[model samples]
Target: MTTLLEGKAIRKIFKTGTVETEVLKGIDFQILEGEFIIILGQSGSGKTTLLNILGGMTQATEGELHYQGQPLHKASDAELTLYRRKEVGFIFQHYNLMPNLTAYENVKLAADIAEHPLEVEKVLTDVGLEDLKDHFPSQLSGGQQQRIAIARAIVKNPALLLCDEPTGALDIQTGIQVLMALKQLNQNYHMTILIITHNSEIAKMADRVLFLKDGIIDHITVNEHPLAPEELTW
Candidate 1:
């Protein structure tokens, strides 16, 4: 029941040609430790923006953000870099792997920057990618590349993992495989995982789901026993 991430009265704004746009309007929420919370929303719903703020990737125009009880806004850039490197892991829809580097090399690049990196081989095996280690991105399928991305994130053994449309680029079967790998990690490692996606089917796999619409949270749902990836429905 301990809070791992919290955003209080969060607000974000942008101005364009004398016009002001408010993206998040006084939204507030909290994520508990070891929880897999999925944020579901349609296009332009501010889900990604909210997540960016949570991960220190971007600052909120207003309000407060605390990660493990420390003020995010007060942290220096170096502190935030360390905060992100050691405490948080990120996965994007587009496999953010270095095309020039082999799968093994790309994962190690991230692990090298971490304060405490998990053994590269252990993480690769966990994601079922040990055999694909030396393959380059161009030599791998979309799914394989994504598995590499997951391995990269898990290699950090971070306190919080942020995934944005993790399976957006994969076919259903491949996406499920990826989710299974991620779900297994959540169950075994007890890492706090936050996934942002447009697919409502994906919410069934989360301990809690936050639904957003037009810069506001429309609803929040909690499932005591989340379904496995194979059991999810749209």
Candidate 2:
């Protein structure tokens, strides 16, 4: 597989007056095309911060970030905006759906802005939410809402999907179902997915698992055969 994204000596620091705290310390990694990568870490290990930097949601304090050989770290604000809109899709722990919008509408909102969008209804059906298209967020359960969020992100037909604790708020069964959907998306669309979570069990479903400790990658393990979501146990 081709290298889709690369990060070299990435670092993030926050400055509050005279105090400077570093969150990422010389992190480096490369993501291959159509790969499913899991980033595992304890809380405050900077997993989310790394994901944000990779997705261009924020810039790294120091180091190089490249996407398909283009320098993402050097991109201007407008370029980053375009890159995010056209190439990257994000799914958060929270559904982040509009309460007033129906499931279909929420997905459509993202589809409308995308340069190359999948059919909204097709994506909803892909996530097994065809019947819930007209339902609002309040009318759905946590898993159902998350499936809708997945649909919203995938409808953009993005090159890379960045998920931050995608199953953090659900029961095991529901979380498994969501994971299965994500797996299916990666399989069917050849989507490159990077997921960050504290749940170590989720790592079994990934092509590669990156262990983060204290803002640095401790090690990377590649699985010869990743298990399905149903086979995972917490």
Give the top-scoring candidate (TM-score): 2
> What C-alpha lDDT values do all the predictions have?
0.90, 0.96
lDDT (tens digit, per residue) of candidate 2 on 4-56: 99999999998999999999999889999999999999999999999889888
lDDT (10s digit) by residue, model 1, range 100-159: 999999999988977788999989988898998999999999989999999998897898
Spell out the clash pairs found in candidate 1.
none
* Over 4 Å off, model 2: none
Provide the lDDT at 71 for model 2.
99
TM-score of each: 0.96, 0.98
Q: How far is candidate 2 from the true structure (C-alpha RMSD, Å)?
A: 0.8
lDDT of 2 at 67: 98
